[model samples]
Target chain A: MSELLSAEIQNCIEGPVVKYGYLSEQIDVVATPQSGLTSSTTGNRVMTDTISEAQNPKSFLLAIEALERGL
Target chain B: MILGLFVGESFAELSVAESTPSSRGTLREHQRWYLPKHGLKAYLQNWLTKTPHKPERVIVSSRFLYKLAGHRLGGSVAQIVTSGFENWSHFASLPANTRSTSLRQLNRCPSLSSQDLIFAVHERILSDGSIGKPLDLSEIGAIHEKLQVLGLKKVCLHFHNSNLNSIHQQQTRDFLVTLGYEIFEPPVVDAFPSLEPFTRWKTNTLSAAVSGTFEESMKEIFEGLSAQIKEEQIFFFDGDLRLHQGEPLYRLSSLFALEACLYSQLSKIMNTKMKSEKPLTFLHFGIEHFSYLTDEKTLTESPWGTLALGTQGCRDFSIQPSSLLDLHDDGSLVTKGNLSYEPGPIHLGRGHKPLVADLLIQETKWPEIIDLDEKQARTSLDRWVLLMQTWQRSVKKLRFLANLLSVCFEIK
Candidate 1:
């Protein structure tokens, strides 16, 4: 198969990130894997209990998933 | 770049995905508590200077408070003053039918006029004390001519205290219909005139207050203004419906505060070149409910300081840190093992980054309000930049600490 990881990883953690978990042919279920920056909207602002606070984390998850799926 | 003024909470309805009355109240509270400390206007101004694609002119409009705030942020960046008569007293207190010639003349003070700046403060005065009198076509004609003389391509009108009725003033909404001015309004607050409750202690300065009102008034004002002017000549910047709620709120971030300073510094780097290119456009990126919890650990270590006294997980995520809402066990924030820090990729969203262009619009009235030629404008800009730098330096340290904590948590 092609390389599972590439420069697109730069969108995440700034340094080396090694994935640890059992890799199946269909899905790569990994344990807690470390990447550059744990992408979260929390880094952007101190969200109160408002909808805006939840938005970043939700969107961040989607973004990470998209990147990982493509990779 | 033409400056576009989005006074008050103009874009909130569009920007925010959804909002409740209480949620909106929290938003306004957050704005008052954090906006000026963030130095939003200065930040946007600096960004305008560095942006590769900028308008040659700018329109700086806002609520009365925003106008005052802009004045507080003096710079070569031009401003256009537009709003209702509530606080026009700050500029000039006049009776009905007083030709703006004198007011415009007053704006000509060396302290007021700057390079290529135009000032158009339109007040709707009816013969009686009621609202919605047709804009004296003569005044509209004069304002229109002034804009034309300045060679302005677009005008962003920050409609403050205008409500829906202000739109009918210019020949029953003729002026705005004709000029095609871009209109913007801030998010709506629960209370129409929030002034009643907080009479004792005003949370925001004049500039911040004005910005909010300006947003509300734009649509009606421009609708009226456009009706009287050339329709094709103007464009309204209502702002993205989804992002509007958060745009003003985002100004509170230490990152955004620092961005303003950086932009200003960058402007100095290219000051000579700035004149040759088109005028710079300042885009204000406001975020909604900037206060939120990442994980419990991250919530404690954030730069936003204590919002209330409670474990974040137990409290409502929508609550802002103000007297109105009591989400905490005590009035203070709990810091035991607090782990909040700079928004990580996980926090910010994987690929969710803000776009610069879509959030900005062209305006052409900034130069006049700042009185570019005078030392006061420059002085004000300097002070604003200085304050932002200080805040940035402070947040930068917090970011470092937060990152360290994030690493520690990851290992654990």
Candidate 2:
């Protein structure tokens, strides 16, 4: 992860998170490039899935692990 | 060359004078649908988390999800609520035990409200329910106060309905302006969507029978209702453009038509209203699809919904096409006159056929004198060119990335 995306993910994790009424102490960051070739094909899709997975922490970690294998 | 933005789907087409190669270059380079489908969650999350900069005044036509947007946008959100006083079990899920009262029925509808930066649309009453009733000024005043408390920076009222002449519609406009709201009347066109991607099947023959400035009509309406609604608070927006919503396939076509009207109207509106500030692109929730995106899965699926095509912005079209203004595919500005539509070759496959209205802009610009006030015309043309260039560049960038990814995978 580049410094900027890593930072953004970190911020999403550390900052106050209130989405659909879920509260989290620590949120993991999954960084994806928006511009590169990898991104044009699948990056946005992966990121969307990750955010959704993070909706429930248990599934989020499992999804992240599964996603990493594809990468 | 005079640059006219023609917004409509397959039926309506724009024509531009073939003055310079740069003209074609400008149109080709600039054609884009600004709203991107991907990365909405990321984009919205980024927008909300950012520190509040300039507060936005938001107005919504529906009462569906003001709270969600309010929480996210963090400023104020206002609504111009409109409705027929009746049971709204379809829209508002009321408790079964609570015997529905007519007053409670009235409350179920959305009305016009404007916060500083955010403006809300008034719920549309298509039939006999809500038009012609004298609106309560207190209701208007109370809504304005709520908008103020919500940290609104500006207020604008947008109302759309089929009954253009009803007493209640007039009163709604009168009420909003009395509370210091900028009221605009958008141009209304009646057209239906196409079933096939590229082909447009004009089932009903449509025309712009009347073409007078809606702003002028609004002034008359406001003045007529002035006996009930106070006069001092109302401000009129000129050359407002709104399109009729019906049919499904005409989604892209109607979108362009609305865009064209908005483009022309905004140019006039900004010049007259703001004087100094230019109008930034305003992203509105698609009128028909307002209720669709709450479920994340739907966002990724098809971008279907009435909000995308069925907007009750202006109530002008009827089934038999009577008692309304008609318009033509030609670039002429007709008001309060009848327009007629004749069937054309449906050869253009759905999505692939170059949009009729978009093409018309190029064709229309081709013959007309692009010359206006030397500086103003140049500035307008330049802005159009810049917008086109930005879109072309964005699409090109996306396509390039897609191709590169394809190559990399093939190499592997």
Candidate 3:
């Protein structure tokens, strides 16, 4: 894992920053167009999944569509 | 040459004119690009590369598109909350039997952002609104670099007692601004200037959730346009095509309000019975679907509850705020898996789908344009009518059965 991501999870410890909740993290990092999706932060207890690099995040496209529905 | 780059939900058009509108004609050549099944950024880059025009002046009539798509096309707003309260948004809406008054029905919704996307920043503002613990800038810098690599540049920040002190959020905002992140500063509602911390955070969070994606998309577009066309004076259109200065807006709820205010008068919204069904995305035709990943919860998924922004935001669309003929396709038509549905130029009639507003930006078309597939339109309407009829019949039957059961179960 790169130092950048590690720093975030490292700071996410027992304090005012890290909340008391389930710690299930899944970050679909678009490493590159060709690299598709990689487990960039999976080792830091974060799971990584590969998705189509070309399309917007599934939910984002939906959100826009929903907001602009009709007009 | 004067150039017009018109962007819409599903199509983009670049029109160039060698002279003024009154002299001969303003449109020498025009080309429309349809969004292929993937990579909007790639598609836009390809579109710009293929356009063989060098524009000295450019006018953009995006209006509503930018506000709705505030983040990168597919990017989400990375949410940051002060420590220990990450789940405040995640679980704030459940009926509080602790309210001490009464309870009502509500949807068990997800927060604007998913847990994975939300990060915790170390900062604390005391109940008395004092800076109890100063913000940790190092942590923010690390997060910035991490997000930079992933091409995510928007942040929705909330700190403890932000409304009271607002110092931590302000400092964090200033820091993120320096780092080039499009921070959606939780707004101060015009009516409620001294808004409580929770209210302010909620307002800002909703805005970020909705408009964050377009931030990246517009940035890419601006960069793409600059690399392609060296136009110095560029003007962007507002909700009603009114030219405005400044960057794209992050407050989608306000933009929607403007659209509703202007177009609602013309739309047939009086018939509540007919408008109940949020007009099923015109049978999902021309709807863009990005449902490859399902498990990850999106901003539109839960906490905000399907296009609602609480008391401060636009009322839920279910109230039929706008036209009855609304074709807003909110992921209702995601093709089961991925289909080979490709969109191309509308004039050539290359595709079967009917993505509207292809030629809308052109002044010649004014408020009317885009070729709708007659066959697709008919099929979609037929299907919708059939679905509604079936739904109405079922509802009537259910109501009758309920009435009968109520009477039978009465203590006579």
Computed on C-alphas against the true complex, the DockQ of each candidate is 0.03, 0.01, 0.01
**Model 2 CAPRI rating:** incorrect
Could you arrange the candidates by DockQ from highest to lowest? 1, 3, 2
Candidate 1 lDDT over B49-139, as tens digits, reads: 4444332222222222212321322122222334342233223111111211121112212222232443445554343434533444565
Write the residue-wise lDDT of candidate 2 on B1-412 in tens digits: 1111121111111121212335421221111111122122232233334423211211001111211111122123233434331222122222121211211112222322212333333345444446444456566666677766765423323243423434544665677666665443322333432222111101110001011122233344335334333334222111121222222223223322332232233333335644744433211111111010110111000111112122323211111011111122342212221111111111111111112222222323311221224454355445545544554554443221122122211111
Stretches > 4 Å off in candidate 3: A1-71, B1-76, B91-110, B136-153, B174-182, B194-199, B202-212, B215-232, B237-370, B373-412
What root-mean-square deviation over C-alphas does model 3 reach?
A: 20.2
lDDT of 3 at A20: 9
Per-residue accuracy of model 3 over B1-412 as CA lDDT, tens digit each: 5555545445555556554335422345555454433244565466667767565555554433322322222136677788898877554323222211110013222244566666798888888877778988898888887778777777888776776787778777898898788887665544445444454555456566556443555565566667565434554433333444335352344332222221222122222424642311110111221111111111222122333222211111110001012122331211111112233223224433322112111112211233445664455545544544554554443221111112111111
Docking quality (DockQ) of candidate 3:
0.01
Q: How do these models rank on TM-score, best leading?
A: 3, 1, 2
Candidate 1's C-alpha runs over 4 A off are A1-71, B1-129, B132-134, B154-161, B168-174, B185-412
Selected candidate, larger TM-score, 1 vs 3: 3
TM-score of model 1 relative to the true fold?
0.25
